[model samples]
Target: MNKITKALGLSLLLSSAVSVYAQQPPKHTYKPDGYSIVTIETPEDVRFHATGLDSTSTGEVYVATRFGDVWKLAGDKWSKFAEGLHEPTGLLVDDDGSIVVAQKPEFTRLRDTDNDGQADEYSMLAGDWDFHDNYHEFTFGPVKDKAGNYYGTLNLSHGDPDAFSLGAMGSSGGYRGFAFKVNKDGEFSPYAWGLRSPAGLGSSPEGELFYTDNQGDWVPTSTFHLLQEGKFYGHPVSLAQRPGYSKESITNTAVEVFDKIREKPVALIPHLEVANSPGNPAWDTTKGQFGPFAGQIFIGDQTQSNIFRVLLDKVNGVYQGAVINFMNGFQSGNIRNEFDIKGQLWVGQTARGWGAAGGKPFGLQKVVWDGTTPFELHNIKLTKTGFTLTFTDKVDVNSVSLDSFSAQQWNYHYSGNYGSPKMNLEAVKPSKVSLSADKLTVTIDMPLTADKLVQIDFPGLKDINGRNVGVEKVYYTLNQLRK
Candidate 1:
């Protein structure tokens, strides 16, 4: 009753503990190589649900939240810089040191008078466009051009009389669903029309403006477009705001007419697989401070709760590119991203109204590079025969084979429907695969076509050390072929 009974009881307890440990789920963590995410602590009482992010020259970070407040981050402290904004979606620290914000009503400039560290001057920069009390008429951007003009994209409203019956996104107010420019004199001019849910906007390293749009009626999927003046993107309902056209006139126009004039997007962000709600396209102007991805575009997805990289190229005078997954597993919906002076990428997150994968309501974080480069695809270029894929590091040439890569191509239909399915999908078989002498590039010879979305999967790709690449898939929007 002493030794035998105690030993039997202890064995049963240990067995139960082991069983419970095996049944528990494994902890999920995001540890991308060569980069680390540092979560920024916010005020316990404040929601800090950020919608826009920007930084000053002195390395002070500013965030505009959906709750109508602008907060500044200096060192490790957060302070309210301004308040009473009407749901600001984008913020810009102008060259003049004034904070210009794209709020729901208008673009407002906030100036910190007397060096009080708080903005006391609230002045309107541009408010020519009309706005009703609709909740969906959000404005994004205020990205400045080289000519000193400020640009903002207006979102289509819901519950409007002129709203398209297909996608339900409409522009009852003037200039809704359009990109407008505010001149230095504060004169407002409509620049480009036919944008639906233009959530993110950014200027390329060359000062060329680009915008990201969500998938909806008239939008096949999430898209990134070069914001050229007078170019119609895709949504036909936005035509009602054009001169000589009313709601009835636009409704009577054929969809073919709009299709013919619709400008192609630089890249189509694949739905579900890539991003459902993509935010700002922040270019890595860090100049190698953020590792090998200098000059590439880093975009955060609000719904996916992740950041992806875009490598852009110009073909036949048009902008097109590929998107590769960069980092994932944020704490909330990553709505805005800004690169600070130290080349660290600050991500502002929110999950209000729409749900996000991160499961948190609001937060802030930054991604820092450890100076080590990961083995990944650097960029992809369309060649006359096929494609030229470059890598950040040397590749294991022995692991390269025809079976290591597979590809498919498809296009979306232009219509009044909500998010067309991938049409005419077909497998693309490569005829030849060649590794470059430097082992940093791969050339594939295949039958190439124009005006299609090409996806290449290289799950078996490895670096010179025989380690797998960081990202295994690449989605390229092929609008043109090389001459």
Candidate 2:
């Protein structure tokens, strides 16, 4: 093909992709919050629950199933990429086009040797760490970094479900309930320990690693933690892997001392409120292709069958943020999701063992922005007085007042117990409401403190067009008072 021919072909490909996304996707309705959720049609045999997925520049999408198969979605057909592996949990397509995935025991790479479109070679890319035969000892990632290293989170072995034993959070093998990295030469090094159950992992566009952990023993709620090197994430079970940081040492340590030492999450998703079992988090890097939510992170929930948006603000070298429920009523249990080249969000879900609110067993859904900037809470930035809320639409200003919003503050207790209830509940009275000159930002008055979770209810708040804000409730974890 000549340069002119190649140029024409490239232009046509781009045009076609844009046209497909321009149309309203089929089998999905417009969300009340100005988005559409569509379930993509898969091959009849692609019934296995998907754990992770990634797409290519040419829009070729691939998924790793919990049943140990990788399939590629080309146009309307789901072609088998590879088969017969362990219970794989995460998937990614490298620059060389080889598919990398995380299985229960190891990380594997699938490559099509003969250009036949079927992966002929299945190589164990990493797993030099440790794994046990326990049912809950699931391996979760390969979230790559700019340096070409792969990372994964290992879940600790759990005890019998009928009995609430403390051993449920204990590690049976080496570095269980920890996050580790593997280099190109396949050198495994244990990095961060003390994670309870890391369900999903991914890196930001800036290449910073982050993972989502479920709420359970030693974890008061589901959270998204910044993957800082050699940091403990508040679970004593995994400390058993670190010699000096054993369970006995943590048990003997006072709560005050533990709080000062343990690394907290960037954002705390309230249990059963925003996320029951939070899955993978995908950021909006599609520029304007996915709407105005560029740079914000979208997190999925398994049991709740919902998705929420998080806005992170770095202050004083620490990360803190807010979470707002974006959409609910997804089919099946959401496990993983990724944005395609066209900015379409393909969500992979499975409800095989755990029941979900969507009433489905498994599904593949896509969420697209319908070009509507719905009235919503876009972000919550911490301020000296309290925090400011930026909305998607211009506010009426008259709709906000000292009596217009209500806030409740509480903190969680980390114990060997299954979970925690809201402790020290207190109502916070707002001193004032100040609207930004752009009318898109509102400064609500509330006294915030360190290590406290605030739940603010934006009651009767509406945009200038009289449309009510979709997400009225916003949750913020104020870990740092100021920068």
Q: What is the TM-score of each candidate against the true structure?
A: 0.92, 0.90
Question: In model 1, which runs have C-alpha deviations exceeding 4 angstroms?
Answer: 1-31, 161-166
What does the lDDT read for residue 133 in candidate 1? 53
Q: How many residue pairs clash in each candidate?
A: 0, 0
Clashing pairs in 2: none
What residue runs in model 2 are displaced by over 4 Å at the alpha carbon? 1-32, 160-167, 245-257
lDDT of 1 by residue, 292-392 (tens): 88889999988778898888988887789988888888888898999988999999999877667888999999999898878888999989898899999
Error of 2 at 145 (Å): 0.8
Model 1, C-alpha of 87: deviation from truth (Å): 0.7
lDDT of 2 at 330: 87
lDDT agreement with native, every candidate: 0.83, 0.78
